[model samples]
Target: MNAQIALMLGQDGVTSGAIYALLAISIILVFSVTRILLVPQGEFVTFSALTMAAMQGGRPVRLGVLVLGLALAALVMDVVADRQRYRAWIWPKTSLALVAVGLVVVGLGLSVPFDRLGMLAQIAFTLATVVPLGPLIYRVFFQPIAAAPSLVLLMVAIAVHVALIGGGLLIFGPEGARTEPFSDAVIELGPAMIASQTLWVIGVSALLTIALGLFFEVSLWGKALRAAAFNRLGAELVGISPEFAGRTSMTLAALIGAVSGIVVAPITTIYYDSGFLISLKGFVGAIIGAMSSFSVAALGALLVGQTESFSTFWASTYKEIIVFTLLLPVLLWRSLRQGSVEDDE
Candidate 1:
């Protein structure tokens, strides 16, 4: 490789990794707080991107408007939905679980229209619809699962994933959809040239990550959320409602998903059924973070981005092959280390 090419690859790797890190962190947030491996996490990304693209006339828009709208909608909807759907079934365990799956299906169904709507309208509608799903899931499942095993929650998460995929296919058809990015600016800094769209992705991802980190680290509610994630009963002893933490975490995760969607839509076309791959890659990034550290997950995401970018440059046809080949070894090593740590504990 040429020296300049190598340098560019390195920079791109960091930027790509940062995006992945945001995704990974979102996954980790849900997993850590709810003790559930939320598979629908990836769909959130798709929903945000599709909605934003649709809202912006199939082009890019101001990051501030996109992020603010997504965050507000996600947070509000999460809170309301949880209280309405989940809080009502606080007694029946089996029924509550079913309700959670049903809601996932419903969310998936609602997200389908994004592919068809005008870009601006799509963003408005998606944000309006998805904001409340987080709260609904928390009220129905995570709250009741406060005393349940992680395995049970894991199964529920898987069910949600299946439901989302099935519903997406049924509603949106099998065709892939494409949307234009917001900008076409390219900047040259010495030997490296960065696409304006990619730069926007990087900048927006960085700002959101930092803001979220600060919110979780500094706010009183944020502290309670952390406590609940680590130990629900302990948080309860301190007069913090674990249910509140679960709801907040879900909303936050969804918000992150929406932001990810907005940032990513410019570069990649989205399809209704695309959630699986996106979620898988994001989950990989989260796993790389050991499912706890947000900062580390962010690092992993950038690495993934670099891997994808460079792999594409080398052999577009075999890009996936090259990426997976690299990912497998890393995953295996991480798994072994985790096993050893558990054994020691």
Candidate 2:
């Protein structure tokens, strides 16, 4: 490829890699805290993108109904079950407030004219609609098995992912969507021109990364999560609820996925299930870091994007093959280094 083409490819790859870095961080965070793989993390991406698309198209967004139904069910479940243990927990009460807020947002989304809603408002609506699905999943599905073996939790995560894929098709239909550009300007520097949207992607990723750093290093809740991840039983002994840690981690993962989706939707046609492949790429990047180091995972994700971008030019049909194949050597190296540990379960 020539210089211009290389620059364009680099730009595209870097933008996509930035998004992948967000996903990698999310995967690592959830895994660290909960020991659950959180496979459906990607579905939130599709959910946010398509739901936003539906609202922007002036259609009655169905998420309002869905969220309300889920809220009622969760309430009933809480009422019927050992609410004696859960009734006073702050997270449950906080979740209820968030659901109430989401209901209001979605209600407005369905009623307001699409043109009347500004771009940021639409984004906020989408965020509200999609982010709750995370904690809800943790509460309804994963929390019950929180003490299960890692392998069992992994199975639960896979099952959750499969269910969400089917549900996504039903909710969003098979059609794909692309959002209006967040920016349309291009900056020319010598022969290489960069889209402003790319700059937005990179800038937002940097800001979020820094924010996450601060939150983890400085915030009490962040420290709580870290403590939980390091030693769950110990955290619980210290009055830190594992359920709370898992729920919070899942919520943050959902937030990251939703934002990544919103940023990426404008750049590509996002189908009901588009998140699977994107998340798979992120997972591969996460694995490259041995799922432990944020900086390393970010670097691996950028490399994944760059490799895919260049490989598509060289062998379009085999680009995925090339991209995925990079994981093998990395995995082998990790396995050799870490050896194996048998699960007590």
What digit string (tens of lDDT, one per residue) describes model 2 on residues 89-182?
A: 3345654765686578667767877656779888887888888888878877887788899899999999988888887787778999988779
Measured against the true structure, the TM-scores of the candidates, in listed sequence, are: 0.74, 0.93
- Per-residue lDDT of model 1, residues 86-195, tens digit only: 87423444334434544543454434544455556555555544545566555554565656777787887778667656755554445555557657778898888878
Per-model lDDT: 0.67, 0.84
Instruction: Give candidate 2's error at residue 88 in angstroms.
Output: 10
Best by lDDT: 2
Off by over 4 Å in 1: 7-15, 53-125, 315-345
Model 1's alpha-carbon lDDT is 0.67
CA lDDT, candidate 2, residue 228: 94
